[model samples]
Target: MKDFQPQNEEVKAIRVLLHGPVGAGKSSFINSVNSVLQMRMTNEALASSTTSDQSFTIKYQTYKIKKEGKENIYPFVFNDVMGLEEKTGVKEEDIKLALKGHVKDGYKFNPVSSLSDGDHGYNSSPSISDRVHVLVCIYDANASEMKEPVLQKMKKIREAASELEKLYYPS
Candidate 1:
């Protein structure tokens, strides 16, 4: 598993976007995947061990896995974003923008507002390399069942992700 590369020549690597409700372990998952790939414990992606109501991550960050003892990186990468909350956290429109590759890395998220075409964080013409190859929603297995509003919001995200995927990979 250490020596991994994408079969498609057009794709340099797969970018998996990770998002979920606040405190769902999205960042931790990125670190975990990184650790597995490096064969060592790594906490490069900061995460709050304690539970909290708000998101610990505020900016959009992409994580690349390095192949141990090799100069090249793995054929897959992980993208971590601010978590979703019912009334706060990352805005839905922001996720949509990210799915379409409009959101650039290091852009701080505004729970109240989404990025527009003119925003510095917005990429008007995102290339295929900037787009997400996969959408991963991390769920907290030990948490209680989600409320209706949050569930509805997640459902909407799923639908939007599907639409974006179709836009990228037409069948």
Candidate 2:
């Protein structure tokens, strides 16, 4: 992978966005990727296997995976969003804005509210580096089916992502 270089030098890293239902192992996936890249078991990102229905992640976070004993950062960045819930969860509008690079990192996501134009965390314009280059929708294999609301939200998100010409991967 080290030999692989981005076609656009203006963008330092390829941003990957991960979206899925609550407790769908998004955080665990990030941790596992980081651990594998570093050749060690690491838990830099918080992950839980609890059965609680409440969402554990609350903010938009970008994680950088670095190889052990190296000062250079990886060419890829993984962005994690608040998990989606049946009744209340990450707003669909917010996800759309995020795909367009309007949502900034560290923005606290409110389940009851969507981001507004005047919000302090909102970025009117973001560079290509800040935009998501790839969108990944994670589904639990153990689950028989997804809730209607959650599925609708995912569909909308996929449409928005497609409009932005971002690579979409369902896993």
Return the top candidate by lDDT: 1
| RMSD list, candidates in order | 1.4, 3.5
Which number leads on TM-score?
1
lDDT at residue 48 of model 2 (Cα atoms):
76
Question: Which runs of model 1 end up more than 4 angstroms from their true locations?
Answer: 69-71
List, in order, the clash count of every candidate structure: 0, 0
- Per-residue lDDT tens digits for candidate 2, residues 1-171, read 555567899888998899999888888899988888788898877877684577788888999987444547788988888888888879988888888788989999988889988899899878988888989987778976898999999999998888677343453
User: What are the runs in model 2 whose C-alpha is more than 4 Å off?
Assistant: 68-71, 166-171
**True lDDT of residue 157, candidate 2:** 93
Clashing pairs in 2: none
Residue-level lDDT for 127 in candidate 1: 79
